[model samples]
Target: MAVLLGPPALAADPAPPSAQGPAFIDWSGPYLGIEGSGGASFGQHTFHGTMIGGRAVPDFKTGDATGRNDRSRNATTAVGGLFGGYNWQTGPWLYGIEADVYGANLKRPVASTAPGLGYEGLDPEFSVLRAKTDLYGTLRGRVGVAFDRALVYATFGLAGADVRILATYPDLAGGGVASTRHDLSYLGFTLGAGVQLALTEQLALGIDYRYLDLGGGGRFGLGALPGAAGGPVSTRDASFTSHQMMARLSWHPAGLTPPPETEGTSSPDDRFSLHGQTTFITQGVPGFRAPYTGPASLIGRQVQSTTTATMMLGLKLFEGTELYYNPEFSQGFGLSRTLGVAGFVNGEAQKAGAPYPKLRSNRYFLKQTFGLGGETEDVPDGPNQVATRRAIERVTVVAGKFAIGDYFDANSYAHDPRVDFMNWGLWASGAYDFPANLPGFTQGVMVEYNRPEFALRAAYTQVPKEPSNDVLDPRVFERAGGVVEFEERHVLPVLDQPGKLRLGLFSNVGNTADFRQVVGLTQAGLFADINDAAAATRRPRRKTGFYVNLEQAVSADLGVFARVSANDGRNESLSFTDIDRSVSGGVSLKGTAWERPADTVGIGTSMNGISPSHRAFFANGGVGLLIGDGRLRYAPERALEAYYALSLNKILTVSFNYQLVVNPAYNKDRGPANFLGTRIHADF
Candidate 1:
């Protein structure tokens, strides 16, 4: 089971106009507030040691031992704090200092297995081991900045935290045994950058990121039961850092004056809109290894590269609507030019000798979306035809559509969703913000459906042959099925706080129809039901899956997040051949990477796994940044991955990535397999 905490709390009131000595008190005020954050987090920690003090006596012979190594962690935290400050607003400068004390429930877990590898001589009485940490703290800070309708600020402070650790060792004798627990405390530092763009005198929206660092070289302990590997021993000290990033909507009551009735020119059309990011990847051939050349010249290497582009276009459709579009392309320049053409057969690569054969030499990644809706403004003077003054000023509703080739999310399995890279679908979404009543929060809902392409259906039925067995033989197979998706998101305020909380839930259902036609030597009565002639005409059955994510922000520069996803699927026609289930969860940190104003970056990672395709467990992460003025441009930071596998071949692997530029490169070396790959990605 997984639980997500809300975001962190920001200062109750806005900072003063100036941080200078006692002069103007134009911006001096006090207020009490609480806040929580919601997002995602990545985990990285190792647990490998023996146990002690059990019934196994001096030998410490342990039962229920999960002697596995290399695992990942994901967790979230909810922070509540109270703060108030005085501000002296002078000319075009605003600066002040605020202090806050916070209570946090942070989740950080480390999983390990040892003293019982592969359950050899191991008792089911003690099969699993898990660890988690709960923490809380108080923070003090001083801030400084300059500007009027907009401002740029830098803040620094010190924080104190207490951590509680939980570890469970399951019993092999049907039921589980009581576990071990530990607690500790530490001091850390926090720093980051933020910007605010005021659209109107009383309404504004902003984004921020923060970084936190807990001291290093803190030792921890783990001992075996009485009969385990000679009691327990002292383990290495634990250490790591975190990042947090967030987007916020703010509104102020009793600040703006009422607009004139039926006046001339009204306030300049004040507009506040938000845009999402889009990324496309194109792959012409399905081969992991380099294209095979002539018989003897096997000196070639398997390589893949994608040419990706991202752009921000003005979104405006009619009086109150938004629309946007972006497209991409990827192809094998060197490999395709050398081997002529290649074909994909059962996740394998085969070569050909021809200029642009029947196969598609080009692949495209495309996406198009738009919405119909309206916005709210503080000033409702006459010239402004679309003006309304209600306690809940903005009840913005938007509906749009989208289509894509492959709808694989970055956090899922490394491989594409379907064996092949092809899919197309559409989506409709809507969102609303309550400024007067709710202060700093928004509500949203979305739904989408993607149809399975013609080729994808063929590949699933084991009929993806050379000239497509469908052409020469009309009795090949029936059309595969399509997928339907439904989702919902909630942005709630942390009571009477400064920051906000976000929660999301999504589900997918895929329907597979029975094979309608058969090609070669088959009697008409042979495969009446797809299950009977499973070998020749295998079709699909209906399957459904779902996932959820929750995140929260503690302050303008600090936040914590967590996410959990699960899926269940089956291909009934082939004797329920491809029936599988998977679940994963992890935590994340945003902002606080750099000290300079323009160097804000977000770093995060997570751990999880599925059956069959996965032998053991795994973890992964991503880092991002806001680069341009008004944060119009985004940049990649870093990504990390580590996993352990149990199978015919056992091995521990570690992978690292540096997304320095929009197009980042990845270098990996695992046993006999070694290669370089470049990839680019974005989220809307």
Candidate 2:
């Protein structure tokens, strides 16, 4: 009974502190900044039940003969959104509050054995179910201590959420469906600690951790939800919580300059710098599904939850414009390196390390990769964290290109936009930087490709469909089709400044050429061969996508940029190919108000939408700000942003959101929301 959670879309923690400058308007003045981020969410729940009667029959322990309890569902979904806020500082103790709200998606499906709950007693076993969680905003307070080159801070706040509970029941004696829905309010608290470590006058490194407590929560029946067996049973509400940790290496907008007094004879080899960032995060969501009201065939629902993680390492080699790789280090800053090696690992799981009751939801990626393999790197969204653990997994290499371990196909655009981070595959990509004969803008082009695979893991300790089953034959791996993509970029001087244009082309080909289709029967006894239907076809599937971007400074406080992308996905199975495309564009604004210690303010926004789909037209965008000076740099951290997405056509959509960041998730199983929704991350 594995429960797949949501994607990593929203971070449970608030945004990071802003970088600052001066308080007055002189050579340097104080300024504010804002930012927003998005990712996949992978937190979820699960529940189970036994037949007590009805369609389960013979009173074999299935439950009531009325056919009121005996159904179940295993549900999972990929969700994402945006949030933003503002910040202001006076002295050492930078102080500010921000709010982030989400308007994206919340989906939770279920899987079950019992047709529905068969409640002959006051408490029904478990069967049909539904889980829905949505939130309005998170308000936070900030306080911190500052040292000459360092600062420590703490934050606290409340998150208001709008949640809905739904359960369905099937008629066993006859044929029909019964369902109920509940709308509720939830209150929670959050706390986090962070530190900034200054490495040089112009560079700094930092790490932060945040904890979120959603309190003891649950709905009616089972432990808290009502039992379908008979009368009302003592029930308790479900509770959810998360924790996150992040590290970053940052550079000031203004490059590091040497002291005027030592300018003349300063050493020429002393101006190099480097930085690194890593993160771990985790979180969970739990609840129950009811099946007693309508359809006599409906099965009862039970309790369930899921945990996941996201691990990333980013390296920055800051040298002068003419950057090159050092053979000794096998790494390059800006120049081409003869050869180099890099590592990338991403993992995810449902009902990770816990017990599966009855309710469950399966992710589409997991269903597509259950078997039929070519390589792990062919899946569109990359690899599931648990799948890369296979001893045979190895890095992929092609002429003039190098990829560490397994990689994702860069060209698979057909499924790119809908893919969730929770079930993401792993990838390793590398390319050589070419020497250019251009000036002002650093110009280089490299060709690269990736292979993305799919796989997942869940706890087998839970009760099996057949009692006495000790060793549950857990599904260790699955194969999804693969993709290949090529990318190229050239930086150019726009209005005497640096900007650039990037171009990419890709294709997704099913690696079933030499693969076999494999299917398994779960304890629940349902055919889990969903992946074989559309993915393992003898006909091939292909996808191609492209994008172009431009960035320029309109003023010290105004910047503008635009990007356009298009994708074509063709499935040969039905001799019917679906062409899906999308285009996005946006801008950025940056400047400082009273610059001191390098504090500054910034804002950015982007507009994106998909061209065609079976759904509707969609659009999304957000804004953000920053407060502290040189507090944290690089690390790709965003302070605040709000975005909205909506469906206009059967396959097109529009989205909007507002976001604020106080803290982020550290571990996949107990961290902040990633904006992507619920996610699962596993590691060896």
Candidate 3:
């Protein structure tokens, strides 16, 4: 079972003494932050016999009929969310009111073999019990003792959660499956204690433990099965409780105001910065012509959704050096778990596990910049950037865990998936096949030389240990990916509009199979499956590609963009999508003419193709990372997408979108699919 609520307050140690005494560190202000939690839950569900219409019904059984007991399972979950509070202090005593909301993924499946009432012999029945704790919130009162740098406290609160339980019996006596679903909005109680430590006036870190009891659990009727006599059975009692441990980081915006300047001390504004953004998307394909299907084909007439939250923290270590860290939480899944399309639909979706919430340290890196004595430009405060001025001609070096796409192949009109196009091929060069781990990230080093007219950038990154694996290869130098890009900025002669053209080349040396080799092995009967051929022929191979991107402002309220790319198709795609060649173009229009200046409309189209060898491999039932329908009738994959976004405010926007895809997975025998989507995004 899944449980939600934040941890309590108590400190492991007292705060260090200050020169001006405990009062010098005030515990009076408002603060906001995020927390991550992990723990296990224990609970059980019992079934009881029922008497309906003067007839007795048999109780359900688990394991064996002779030994009947409650169905129970222990679940471990990782949860995360945002929190805020205000505090006041009176001498050594502190009090506050805090609120928080979090989400978790916890579930269990049970099965058994039992004798059927209608059938003479034993029959197999299985049930999947899932508790989707989508959102949980708490309003609590805190009391603690402040010790200048640390606080020890206890908290009690009112907690609530939106929980749903889904149980399915797949093999009933009558032949079809039976299921019962319950949606619950529960109000509960929480109590706990923990400690917090202040690393600085504006930043604090804490850890705590808590206990939660949701309180509404008991026997309930589940409607009858088709051929059963007594109508549906009921569970005896089903309750949930959890003990959780959580870690939190808090920031006080007011505390960020610099204290009276002291000799040789840096200003607080220059030392630290924080920013965050969130996006929620719901997408569905109403229907498609699916004549045939395989393991990776997209399913029609299904809606799926996802939500992502990211917090960026940055510290200026020195005059020209900065360090940044991003903590991100993501929930939900893409259509068909993000498969079946070479140029996939959503860039935000990860090739990970089932649809569930997860927390990850997405990016951390150190950057150093050196001025090259040119004109300076003022940069605004944002994630990974400080509100400062920098030379137009400068050199920057960065190293650590990050995404290669974060710095390279950027376009003004089509780069950011959150604000621009959602298709992978449209936002990024489809044929580049950038190296990354399961969550689309990598450890790498990048260097850039920038000037007003042009910029040169290069990087070397670690590839996955194996194709599409979550872990990176330890032999990064031996199995690595590298890229170099040159960007030129210019103004259109007659229109006098700003534009940029970027040319980039990329190469990856990794353990990949050759499509031709696999096809030959399969044709010769040396291998029954292309995957076996790939395994047998796995060796270090070099894959190379090039791309050209163009972005131009056609008018004050209109922008246009285009991309062309191609990669060698001899070897298997080591990362990214399966396209060997790609071309995409699009235009964006602001709603100024319609008097809604904050609104935007966009239209785009793309065509993706594979080499003859690659197509032959798929036609023979070969599978790639993103596409492969067991078998194929080869054709180019083409897609058209359009969207309209309306801004509700400066911090929030909503958009409606549609996409039409032809020859999905490059298989002409399958679908020309249509998808509808809605997106809500917020940045602060």
Candidate 4:
């Protein structure tokens, strides 16, 4: 809301109207909420491609279950979204206008492409037909009847969705696979109903059901696949319909009765807040030497760009309880399709590529803090955190969808890639295979005990069922990831400036393969699959690691940071990169002496290494999440990164970055490569 109301100031909340027990439900007000949803999308997926030098088959339909093009397509997804509206109440009748949007997980995983699956398994080099709804939203009108504190309502609206369909076929003429992807926009109608109960005049809990019909429409061209110039070009379309069940916790900024209060310090009764940011990055690499390449090898010469925009919305449910949602739009690809290097550049890029800008909810979480009698600190208002007076020593619990890195292994000088170091190894611990989906976020619970000098935190999150899969394991508590960290704040003995040290340990149990075993299996000829043998031997296993992150400020404008992390490289990488061990450090300096206090310069370097088994896997032609050179003259991957960011304004910054990567992919045979990039960021 700074956009309209001006930059936020520490405005104290007025005492709420005295509680009246919701005797007469007041539904007239401005409201907003974050909701979680689960549902099935049953629709029709149509191929609209033209094949050349191939059979002139009608539609060229495949994988329709019924072996027909007219049959419905089915998929399931867990979703999160945000909605807000203004309501008018006429006695017991209530009416309002609302809008909402959701991001979906609708990818089909290719578990074993290891020369296995009877010659029909999904392969890494090629793909069968698959479709995903990246984003969808609605503009609706709502009408409901209220009785006491309960309200029953129905909603109908206009809806739109973005769908992407992709597949690949063998290009016999070109002797390569022809990859094609089509993105579609569908517009239709939606109708939904729900029941809500007001816990207090300002708070409500509700369950909603929606039926959305994204009308079958439009066709998109795939253009010829990059490697298959003379191959068939393709087009596709999808008609979507979904049944969604959603649970919402809403806050009415205008309330007839005040909410009940309990112990602990509270912020201004301001019910909701908003913050936003946008970042654009473009990078390119020049020519380097390479006699051969593998599935995950990076191209010697290539250029690519990525863009992201996000809006953070937060709501205060009551004292000590708050909810926040982050809706994001992302587009473009990482260099070499985000492969080849353990410390791949561009943390802004998601593992899942988006050919076009797609909107989605990346984070939506609820936080409840329990305070013990202690000193208070003034917490500034930022994206997800609201300005408030909070206990210095308290217990805080957060549950929902969020990035594990957002809460763990934090270093003021090197943690944020968007604003600081861009190398994965420089920005993160590099060895902790933290749980995350395609977008670098996972659902979980995090508990933290905070004090003035020290803090301790623990987290448990859903893990991916398979390495690099978009879908999460259903067994949240059983097959999941857990992390615990101890953070200490101190002052340098001589400098007396502030410094912090964070020690973290992480463990996860998931369906994974040990690198040693996968190599042994292929060597013994049991699976006879040298390609991703880990895929064939994947079973429930545990992987653990620890990290030490330290940040110290020598002067008011100068700070230094370092991280040391490692994991037992026996198992194949579950999430993040292929590095089993990593050490990274950096220094950051403000341009205050130069009269540009907001400007900054950062220089950092990292050495990333993999275990013996991991090296053997690559030597055996096994592909990994990011690095696999097909050949091995094993050495640690080393990189040095430096950047200078200039502040254009309070909310805008432009940065120039350069990175030198030696032994790319840990292969001593490949020479050092250089990466150059620029980033533009704005936040308010």
lDDT against the true structure, per candidate, is 0.28, 0.28, 0.73, 0.75
Alpha-carbon runs more than 4 Å astray in model 4: 1-269
Across 356-399, the per-residue lDDT of candidate 4 in tens digits comes to 34678899999998989768776656779865667889999999
Q: Write the per-residue lDDT of candidate 1 for residues 1-684, one digit (tens) a residue.
A: 010011111112333446322221123233233333332111223333323332111112334233322233433333444444433434435566545554554555454334333234544344233433344343534344432233445556665556555555544444545456656565778675444333333433333334566554444655443223333433334443444333333444333221211222223242322222212121232223322222211122333222211222333334443343332211112222222211110011111111111122111112122222233234342211222222222222222212211221222212221111111000001000000000011111222321211111000112111111211112224322122222222334663223212222222112222222321112355544322343444332333343333334444544333334433322221111111221222222222343222111223332222232111100011110100011111111112222111110000001122211110111111111122221222221
> In candidate 1, residue 89 scores what lDDT?
38
Q: Which stretch of 10 consecutive residues in model 4 shows the poorest summed lDDT?
A: 109-118
Writing each residue's lDDT as its tens digit, candidate 2 over 402-441 gives 1111122232111111221111111101111011011001
Better of 2 and 3 by TM-score: 3
What overall lDDT, based on C-alpha atoms, would model 4 receive against the true structure?
0.75
Task: List the candidates' TM-scores in order.
Answer: 0.33, 0.31, 0.71, 0.66
Per-residue lDDT, model 2, residue 420, is 13
Error of 4 at 201 (Å): 44
The RMSD (Cα, Å) of candidate 2 is 20.5
